[model samples]
Target: MALPSPPLFIVFNASSGGADAEQASGRVGDLLTAAGRPHEIIRVRGDEELTRATVRASHAAREAHGAVVAAGGDGTLNAVAQVVWNADQVMGVLPQGTFNYFGRTHGMPTALDDSVAALLSAREQAVTVGLLGERVFLVNASVGLYPRLLEERESAKRRFGRRRVVALLSGLGTILRGGSVLTLELSVEGQTRVVRTRTLFVGNNELQLQEIGLRHAVDVEQGRLAAITLQPVSTLRTLWLLIRGALGRLDGAEGVDSFAFDQLVVRMRRRVRWVKVALDGEVLRMPPPLVFRTAPRPLRLLLPAAEAEEGSA
Candidate 1:
């Protein structure tokens, strides 16, 4: 049986990845009709319409006492998240992105039927977000080769299929070849920590501790940020760890400095080259010396498998 009030808003990306958003809408509508969950499919017409439309959806969900289910990729998720963060609405994701980092980490369903089933059954949690002033991110925020590599990935996605592995290989290859590492003069837990590295990752929830070289298991929902600062012993060694980490072995590497903290401030030394940054999967060109902080219980999100697993633990 469906809840008294069904999901009132499903943010649709009709032009997402050039796939017919209407197709996704129709398919999801079929699921909703079958499951008896009430929802409205919102088609975003233009970038200019996003803010207003998002706000409108947020308001509608609140009035209907329903959830706002994001129906596209990370970029679309970020957009919908902006308006619905603090309001009385639950957030659900239907995972249709090239790399659904947040969804994959949480064990979200990939198939349409299974994904909708999870959404209809899951409990909601007030999820934390990594915030940079006005910017809010559900996953990690990073600077360096991360964002540039994403640009390359998008280009690769266009050239190859969205599911191609070579796009990842290309990004991995770029990271393996030494890119310009930067220095961050920062403070942690009221002490000074100076870091110099090419890869700086601030994970908001949990750093995906894979079978990779990174050995530390850091949890983000514990009201802290997990940070990994890396210094290459040698270019070759860095490449080895990167490959191992990609293969899920980063937690065991020696040169990787991992820690948990409430905030991080990076101090810039000079005008750096191409500071391509990322807030989740959305890429950005950022000015140096970024400040990152955690907003505790910032947004309510559907956590099906992960929350179930957490309860069992």
Candidate 2:
């Protein structure tokens, strides 16, 4: 017997990427309606409202096990996932962001209408999620240069507009500026190790590795995270590391270290109370020491039929 389709409630971020949220939401609604898919759209002006709206929407339509769709970028998706993770409801994505990493990682279409269609026909699957306290992240999380680069991107967006080119330039500038070195003590599998590096990156999504052309270099979905560190080095050497990491040659890259672990506790040597971290491309000031671990339960993600099969395989 064919299963009934669940109701969909979309939460749109007005300032996501560089697109007009209302027009995008309207397009999604029009397409879904024309295709006989019933849904409700809630357009939000700020990120703070996404969590509340998603939770409320999910509960209001609990009888249907309605799916809550994030109609924006990875950050917006992360916000929605925080409310829906481990719940009885499912989660969907409309990839309307600069990178659209999470959505694209799950085989979602870039075009708004196509993404909506994909969601309506998507298969449900269990996917791992990374958590820091109550917050949930679909991709990777990092401390150090990554957060600084995000901050730089925002500053550049305000100065040179929100074009991709400007964001690229801003990233280049950030890279050239270098970053602070962090001394981290990591505890994993009843063992402890200390290291110093320019950045600490923890990832749970293998799609990110593939996106960077490193599919063969790392696997992030094996019930563990691919933790990578870029050790402090000269500017030229750093660039080399970046290129090598992207090409799946990170194992031989100088000043780069990679490992896989189920749970990690990172403590800063300085014992700072708070640290700036970037999760799924969004920057936040979080208190330390940061506890990193994969949620034991997988998030129920909606993926296209083909993508679902591929993931299962």
Candidate 3:
């Protein structure tokens, strides 16, 4: 028999998705109450507060195996998941962010009411998580052009406010601005090779890869990481890949190679002291020689049963 579900501890970012987070949290609380599910909602302002709140929730939920739900975008979910990953506490998502990639990948609804309902009637599964040093990410991690795109997106958001159009314009600007390629020395599968690429992407979720027709990996739950490298190519070629990705046919895109591995050591041939890398939409500057591995410990996540079945099928 399965263990009893505990009271939910929700970590909500009110300023997310360009809406009043307080109003959103209130609405979620109302929904949970109406559903007769015992839940406690905690509002956080930034990453630090989110970490503290999740820690509190994790302790509070220990008695009942309750889940900790992140009510925001991939960045918010990433922060919360890092705190609760591989722990007894389960992780859930409300997906109130602009891209909702993590939630959608798990077959969860993006709407507030539907998301809460799904969480209340969800099951726990051991999901794979990617590890970059000490940080845990539920989505994908990358180096190169992707991080530059994220920087552009943040600048755009600050200047023109957060909107889908802004994100698009930001991406366009990044692609047009062009990016420098990295000479990477990679050690994987007991063989070492050198790659000159503009971007190196590591994916932890197969649903995301399949959505974009990336075919980076066949299974995310297989305790392995899916990595893709976009060779140094012309800006137009990169743009063409984006266009193909938009149409869900990126597999055949030229200059793109995908592979699977359990762990890998990546180094910059030029030996920079630090490099910009993006994990689950959050960018960070880390020391060179980034070591990436997969944690098969399985992060327990909540998703709608119907959608889960559909996704499995």
Best by lDDT: 3
Q: For residue 243, what is the lDDT in candidate 1?
A: 72
Q: For model 1, where is the 10-residue window of minimal lDDT?
A: 209-218
TM of each candidate vs. truth = 0.86, 0.92, 0.91
Task: Compose the digit string of candidate 3's lDDT tens values, residues 142-225.
Answer: 999999899889888878977889998889889888988889999998899999999999998777788778765475646688
Whichever of 2 and 3 has more TM-score, that candidate is: 2
Worst 10 residues of 2 by lDDT: 210-219
Residue runs of model 1 more than 4 Å from their true location after superposition: 1-3, 17-21, 45-52, 86-88, 205-207, 211-215, 232-234, 271-275, 286-288, 305-313
Report clashes for each candidate as comma-separated counts: 16, 0, 1
Minimum summed lDDT over a 10-residue window in model 3 is located at 14-23
Ranking by TM-score: 2, 3, 1
Using lDDT as the yardstick, the better of models 1 and 3 is: 3
Candidate 1, 50: how far from true, in Å? 4.4
**Overall lDDT per candidate, in order of appearance:** 0.71, 0.80, 0.83
Please give me the total number of clashing residue pairs in predicted model 2: 0
**Deviating ranges (above 4 Å) for candidate 2:** 1-4, 16-19, 213-218, 246-248
